[model samples]
Target chain A: MDAAAHDTHDAHDEPHLTPYSVYVGIWLALIALTGVTVLASVVDMKHQAIFVALFVATAKSTLVVLYFMHIAFENRVFWWFLLSAIATFVIFVLLTFADYAYR
Target chain B: MSSDTAMPDLPETNYINAEKGLKSWLTTIDHKRIALMYLIAIGGFFVVAMGLGFMMRLELLNPGEQFLDGAAYNRVLTLHGVIMIFLFIIPSIPAVFGNFCLPIMLGANDVSFPRLNLASWYFYIAGAIVALFSVAAGGVDTGWTFYVPYSANTDANVMLPMFAAFLLGWSSILTGLNFIVTTHRLRAPGMGWRQMPLFVWGIYATSWIAVLATPVIGITLVLVLIERYMGIGIFNATMGGDPILFQHLFWIYSHPAVYVMVLPAMAVVSEIVPVFSQKRIFGYRFIAMSSIAIAAIGSLVWAHHMFTSGMADEGRIIFSFLTFFVSVPSAVKVFNWLATMYKGSIKVDPPMLFAFAFIFLFSIGGFTGLLQGALSVDIHLHDTAFIVAHFHYTMFGGTGVMFFGAMYYWWPKMFGRMYNRTMAYVGFAMFFVGFNTLYFPLFIAGLKGMPRRYADYLPEYHSYHALSTVGSWIMVTGILILFANLIWAIKRGKRAERNPWGGATLEWAVASPPATHQFDGPPEVGEPYDYKIPHLGDDESAGSGADEGKA
Candidate 1:
């Protein structure tokens, strides 16, 4: 297979934006998200805080996955995988709450 | 006209020249070579651990401290778990098949990180050496789980082996990352997500779990080491830290860890099921998605393992429900496999035979796990032999059986040689019979109120323990026969055809022991298990599914 076939289908290869812009944007976003996570940790939201911090982290991770990892423009499998992973995390949280609350 | 019809008369693959000595094996980054390394390493550790197992069994032969005292027994048992779980099962699938087939299946020349791939082998060896050092250094008596307080206080060789394990986890994480990136960035043209083979899906799912969950263990282990070496109070109950918190952090990584061990095996089954059935996998999208689902959900249910470890009552209930939720995707995969087999011309090759065994054994393992999932049931059976039996059935019976089966299934394409099928069949029978003999009696021993991790037992449990010990010998003998068969085949086996089993995946489309660059051109993107196409060389007709086998 022509290795060049990959460049044509890459999501970021569109003419509207240069590759430089994409890279810069992704780096900035990652930095901002890391800052947010650190800031959220310092504030004492008590029991509600862990979820808050995780939510922000998850959002940042999504950006990284979508752009940096290139899953956003890739096949439906990546999206399904990310969604499934998040859904499982939700289920875990819900179950933990149920166990702690009921018993 | 086929653009890539002529087979390249490549140099003899390392496989055909199996006796080129250490240099050929070391310099080679072929997946098969790496797989052999894994086979040797895991086999060596299995023997050492099995010896420890026999000593434990011998001590319980007639009960009451016959062979070794409690302290020695505990230390040896801890060493046994450390070796078997970390050294054997955790790396079983990913190292073996993922090393051998991942790049080839994707039609890439090699893994995206080939040097790191070889590095993982070195790290594995290093880890094993460190593990041996720990064993020789008075041995760690803390269970493999290493529940805090005691782990921190114990004078056993905790730091070395635990550090080795931490490095092993890092190696696993890197491999997972490699596979994820490779699968995403490296597939041949036309091998879209829907068209990608299931083994890739299994690895893809497992990679995600490894990347996300492994680091938590890294952090947790650091905390343990800190408490042990630096006298920090992270998990020290006497120092005002909760010991159960360690369990919390531990299972967070450990529980999902079982999936890291098993998902690739599931992937192996997915590949095997469709091939032998002579049918396209039923619900290809669902099966693929379910693997990812299982990976994600599997990680979340780790808390369930800590239920009897003195978590809050509410925590136990929550963990139980999450455990049930996690089972959904696994059940989905099982149902799809059954559906794939329905009304199909299912051939019972050795690999298919093992797939059938995986379904039966894993199902037993899965169902028995539910008993522990229930809050009341676990309280009674938490530390019993029932839990031990259940764990083995899932891991040993589930992944272990599938691992052997996968080796048999992919042996030809990976090694370019076929094993003696009759010997293969005999090996399977011995393993199957011996496995039951070994573990089923443990189930009996478990139900009779026999607790785990103990070297000696009451006289009443003596006969059963003796039976179990004898059965273990049978199991060991079966494994020995398997290795012997594989070794003989490597030396004197018949040359394999490219599509020896009539398998339809891209890996089968290449020459046996494919060239340094795995494929000459883009692989034919097609129905993964299709075998009846008019011209198998034509990529366009490959995925059309029109000529799929008729039942």
Candidate 2:
């Protein structure tokens, strides 16, 4: 495979490289989310503060993963992989919160 | 320990003898050698942990302070759980047998990432050292669960063992990643997912659990560490944390971790059943899908362990339902194995006997598990000897029994030697009797309300304890004999034929113990369980799994 990829020099054989502009855009989005996070912290949302902070953090990470980290151009296999992992984390948080909610 | 050379002129140049010296072993990227390294390390941990269990059983024999003080007993119990669980059982089948067999079965030279495979072995060793260090450093008494306020504030060296678990989780995650990728990328060109052996499917499912679920424990343990060292109060109740939340986080990983311990044993049984029965595996696809189903459903049921930890009733009901659902796939597997054996020319070898034992023992483990999964029943049986007996039935009786079974099943293929068959039977007879005697009494005792993790018991539980302790001695004697026989076979046993079992898998097509490079080049892929391939089923005591290139 290595030899074929090297010798073919075909465009299809090349890895899907994320454009520089896309990474810069992701970086800017991340900075904007961070600014929002900081601003949100200044005002107390009481029960909503943790949720608000988590949402912004998740948004920043998703952008970084999809664009800056190049999962955007990767195979659908990886997309499902990322989704399942996130789902597992969500189920964990949701179920643990079940105890809190009921109590 | 008779070795009447099954194949006297066995090849001198296989994986074990191909490499020499400790340095070669340490640096080698060969998965088979890495497997042997894990076997020796894990085998030692098993014996040590088994001995700790024996001590616990002995202490329970007559009640009040027989030998170990209560504090000492707590430490011993912790060591037994920590060593057996985190160190021994989790890695036993997958790390040892899966490593030795998976790639070869797939007709590949090695796992997708050979270097990472070796690195996983090193990680395992590093974790093991810290675990042993914890034992030496006055041991941890927080029990294996390492729950709240006590685990948070205890001065007993909790840090090292937690650190060990964290490192071992990395080892597990990496190994699982390697297997997943290997199964995806490295299977021989002709071998489709459907054509792959059921054992591969088992490991494939287990690897995902290892990869996805292990880090939950890593994070949970890190939280505990932070709470302990920094006193940030993530879990210690007095310090403004939630202990029940801690249970949630801990079991989120630990429960699925149970599947990590047993799925590979099921996988081994999948392989052993059809081969010994001399029949095509009935419902191969169902068996394969059940492995996946178990992994997926198994992950969701983690909170079942927390049924009594003040979890919401809704969560308990949901988890309980998922727990019952997970049992369906396992029952499906058992049913299929039975179906495969029905009216087949069943030959009883040591491996087959273990498979038979696995079905029976794991059934006990599974049914008992169902009883606990019921919300109402679990409330009654939460931390009794019943839970202890239940897990041991699955883990030891199920996985541990199959671990030896896998040893016998793959003995010729892995080591190029066959142990004394009669001796194996003798050993297993004691093992079966001792295993039953040891744990069945615990079930009765548990029903009568004996608590687990206690050094002493009430006089009412005395007879049960007495019977169980004696059972442990018998069980250990048998286990030791089994181990000794295998060890004796390595040096003096008769040479084994390449395909001694007439297995249809690619591993049997290679020389016993397999060459450093397993296949000459993508040798034949078969219907993995199909016995109808010519000469493949010839073995009523079949030999020569040499390929006809039949699919």
lDDT of each: 0.78, 0.87
Report the lDDT tens digits of candidate 1 across residue range B480-500. 787777778766767655565
DockQ of each: 0.31, 0.59
True contacts kept of each: 0.52, 0.52
**Candidate 2 segments whose C-alpha is farther than 4 A from its true place:** A1-9, B1-8, B535-551
- Model 2 accuracy (lDDT, Cα): 0.87
Q: Write the per-residue lDDT of candidate 2 for residues A1-103, one digit (tens) a residue.
A: 6977767766645798767887777788888999988989899789898998889978988887887777888778888888989988887778667667777
Docking class of 1: acceptable
Query: What is the two-chain DockQ of model 1?
Result: 0.31
Span of ten consecutive residues with least summed lDDT in model 1 chain B: B542-551
Model 2, C-alpha of B160: deviation from truth (Å): 0.7
- Candidate 1 has an lDDT of 0.78
- What are the iRMS values of all candidates? 3.4, 1.5
